[model samples]
Target: MTDAATRLATLAEEALGAPLPLRIRAWDRSETGPPGTPVLILRNRRALRRMLWKPGELGLARAWVAGDLEIEGDLYEALDQLAGLLWERDDEPAAGRPARLVTAWKAARDPRVRHAVRDLVALAGPGLPPAPPREEAGSTRGPLHTLRRDKQAISHHYDVGNDFYELVLGPSMVYSCAYWDRPDAALEDAQHAKLDLVCRKLALEPGQRLLDVGCGWGSMVLHAARAYGVRAVGITLSEEQASYARKRIADAGLTEKVEIRVQDYREIDDGPYDAISSIGMAEHVGSVRYAEYTGILHRLLAPGGRLLNHQIARRPEPDEEAYHVDEFIDRYVFPDGELAPVGRTVSQLEEAGFEVRDVEAIREHYALTLRRWVANLERSWPEAVRLTSPGRARVWRLYMAACALSFERNRIGVNQILAVRTPEGGASGLPLRTRDWRG
Candidate 1:
């Protein structure tokens, strides 16, 4: 029989193109390997003992975090390969009948945090719609500063290396837009369709000035400027993202038409933009200040100007399990983010003095988008592991899995709302579509 060392060597030779560079140390009695093809497996003494005694995925992940399991070379790819051969790929699993019924019951009530009682209510009682928003007490604090800080929460995941993101995100790196209407569309096509859809909804015209709030790496801004011939200004709180966006704009020779600002939306004094787009940013506005947040956009737009508030929202009425799972995302992924249902969103816009013209739900589309992202991330895990620590990799893995689950289960949704600000009490007669335009 081959010894453990020889077996590992043989496995390494077959799996990886190069020989393994294994290092064993008494510091925690850990073994680690360098980056390369296949996986560079690392095992600590504790993990080794555990594997010998009993084996489980939880044990494996824990060992990896404990510095027991290490991998080198394309961590994302390694993970992907392992997932194809190992982990269950189901989007959502079917619980037993009783458990499913219980979960179904819990998901029927819209509550702060669904308790067992709520589940009973969902199972036994009539469904209640989501509670309405209260009057704005308004804050004495600066909303712009709050906006910037809120942006940080949204951009946190974006800092997880563009390469890792690229593995999961579509080729266009358009983080916000994905067309869910077409089930068979490619990521690039879906994203482009989303962008075009937004442009159409906003009624983008050549020479129209556009503002993108919480613009991620300037994807929307760049696309609008180039495709629609609009002068675009994008604001983001992420310094790294702002720098990257600026470089991208420069590279595309769009410096003349596109401006990337590393500042908070509230701090922006220059506006009266022809249109506004805030994709995936409204969730961070907090339910408390929804009116004010939208009001600010309305005030900044030109008369008869339109605004697209693209965000994740909950259903007007939701069950207990959905509430529980959504709260989990708030604590782990979004931190300060809160999602209001579409009814509340529209009502808030109306309260802010804007007329809601349309509402679109891309929930199913986002579910598909997230699944693709997961597949991409899995495929790139090997590279991801090599570039990042096990803890980081696990965090992303868990986050992606949770997000995918959230979309699949309808605990969350994305809304693209087109709202128009009436001109001076509905007096202006601006043409909806202009034929004569200057580029």
Candidate 2:
């Protein structure tokens, strides 16, 4: 084996408590191979030593960004291992009571840090009320617009600059997987197919009206209007997004068919649509009102109409540390957002009188998506930095990196659920074979 491989073998053995199992191939230091390879590939022992020494969060993060360290196999798994490396307990003595006192002292000095710490702590703490007000917005935004306020939290990170997003998310701004149910398809093709797949799952038809909840920049709206021949109404709380989506719809010459309102889903007046889709939006629906929130969608959809709820989900375990990081997302990237497990989601849907028809776990798909996004972000960082703040760049990196790790470790997941309401006073008479999407 080459010397670089030899050093990597040693580091892998130490980190994993076993020798490396697979053959290692060092690339041209450019991180430019498959879509989801390691962050970087080190060529020599010194570089590996340097990465091991400056072992703070940012340093290791930069090492990945700079293409100094690398991994193979699942990208998300690699990231989880890397994250664990940051907090690894080395030879340093564990301080007992003094550490607790120091932590208390630090918490007392900075309320912001204390809040952050508390959020993490609460995830692991005892059960609390279902719908506690997120601390980010204190009594100011009010209940009527609480959802809007949370939507703004999601918009903050996404609306930084269209160009930045374009670089990372690509032309579609899909924000979700491409539905690679079939092999040998390209990413763009898979994305378009996924959009079509959603439309088909909803069984959308020409002239049918559809409502898209939490439509980001209106990709699905435009797609449905153009491809499925459906009139689409999408609601978003982001001013920037609404404006852009409207312009895109107008430019597409489908102004009559597609309209996006800069309003909360609760305020959406054009209801009784034939179909409903909430892609990447359920995360923002606080757990306190999962039932009521879904009931609202059921009421909004016409009888027998389908509702597609796409969301990221947590595992069944009551993991508090996981919740802490999730709370961080609410505070920073997605204000007022809450992630629910599959059981909670299905229960809420069932309570809303909707029969769950299908559910698919796109965990690895999301990992691949985030991995590509991070890579695109890194590739375009130089140009991207000129357009946005350094903090913004760091936030994107950390958020996407953490997300990649989340999916890689199976700590989180993405689910696309198709549900339909019964037509009569009770269950719908529709055939189970009606679930087929041949059309």
Candidate 3:
């Protein structure tokens, strides 16, 4: 009789028509596949059953989250090897579900794959489908990106314990990508440089007003107030973030210079701010509401004021309607987040009545930043698992690792877009050599 590990690999290959890139270690202490590759550890039969029920990325994610599947050896290498088969190998504009269904339907009719499926079902054993991990996001409460639904989404992602965040973010506490002068610069320096660069681009001056939308833990607001002498207001939906930011402001004795509000961007009516910085926040605005979001920022800024929008961008699909959010990301990471191409975002900003000045791609910087975050989490592994659950920690590890690879491969990117609310005469208030501000 075939050993469990060998049988699992053989059956999967029979269905895939290609060899798996890694080894597998089964719960029965059986091992198979390439000798030097990372081991995909099946800790129990439940992992197979989870995959059987869901049958794709979500099932794989659920198994990992439930502590039933484990990765041994180099995690990044393992993911990179599997990328061809599982993620980030799109050959064309998203074919959408109909095309995928056609492919699946054809595969289901293949006799070899049918035989493999039967064996896999028997291997998974007899049981009800496993419950999804508790950490997964539940169904939306209202219309997508509605104020109520958005709030819930933000809370789900950001309200994970502050201490846990502190462990990952370190002392600087900035959630977005750090600006790096050298590839090996410390995380703190990189983060400070990022904040300073944003300040310089906006030309912050003493007594000027600055608004930071979707401010996580008030890092940008505090940096602006402390370094540029600007009065800053930071808003977020997470009560935990608001409370933490308020305390940081008070501790830094910046209460007079900075204010942290538990508020929504849509609810904010105070306008004519000298500058606005929306960092890593626009993704949650959703494609449906992004124009409204950009327009709101445009309306809030005073004439000649600048807005620095830092955001992640996905490759634009030829058929935009075919672009589907990643199921693992939607359920386990950012619930309502939607990444748009940088071109689309710039167009939307222009439509919202801003004169776009410059667009800088910092794709590599984010890859570096995520690598640092993963290192931080790993170094504090015992505490991180204690602070959150093992499942939540696993979710972060997997998502961050996968994202780092995505940025490296240019499958995704991050950009800092600088635009101005030009006045009647149309001056952007920018220097002729604006590139110097990036440093």
Name the candidate, 2 or 3, with the larger lDDT value. Answer: 3
lDDT of each: 0.63, 0.66, 0.90
Model 1 per-residue lDDT tens digits across residues 364-390: 788777767767767777887776555
Sequence-dependent TM-score of model 2: 0.69
Show model 3 residue runs off by greater than 4 Å. Answer: 88-106
lDDT of 2 by residue, 1-439 (tens): 3244444444444334433333444432322323444434554333333333343443344444434444456555555444443432221234221122123323344554455344433322344222221222233256622665666565665667776777778888777766775544466777787788889888889999999998888999999999889999988877777887888899899999998887777776567989999999878777666776798899899888889898899866455445433433544466566777888899889988998888888888877777777888888888776777554565677678788777876778899998987688766534567657744
For model 1, where is the 10-residue window of minimal lDDT?
Answer: 130-139
The residue-level lDDT of candidate 2 at 223 comes to 97
Ranked candidates, highest lDDT first = 3, 2, 1
Weakest ten-residue segment in model 3 by summed lDDT = 96-105
What would the per-residue lDDT of candidate 3 be over residues 77-182, giving only the tens digit for each residue? Answer: 9886666555433443453312221233247788987888888889989999999999999987657898888889999989999999999999999999999999
Number of the candidate with higher lDDT, 1 or 2: 2
Candidate 1 deviant stretches above 4 angstroms: 1-155, 317-328, 425-439
TM-score of 1: 0.65
The candidate that wins on TM-score is 3
The TM-scores of all predictions, comma-separated, are: 0.65, 0.69, 0.96
Clashing pairs in 3: none
Error of 1 at 162 (Å): 2.6
lDDT of model 3, residue 270: 90
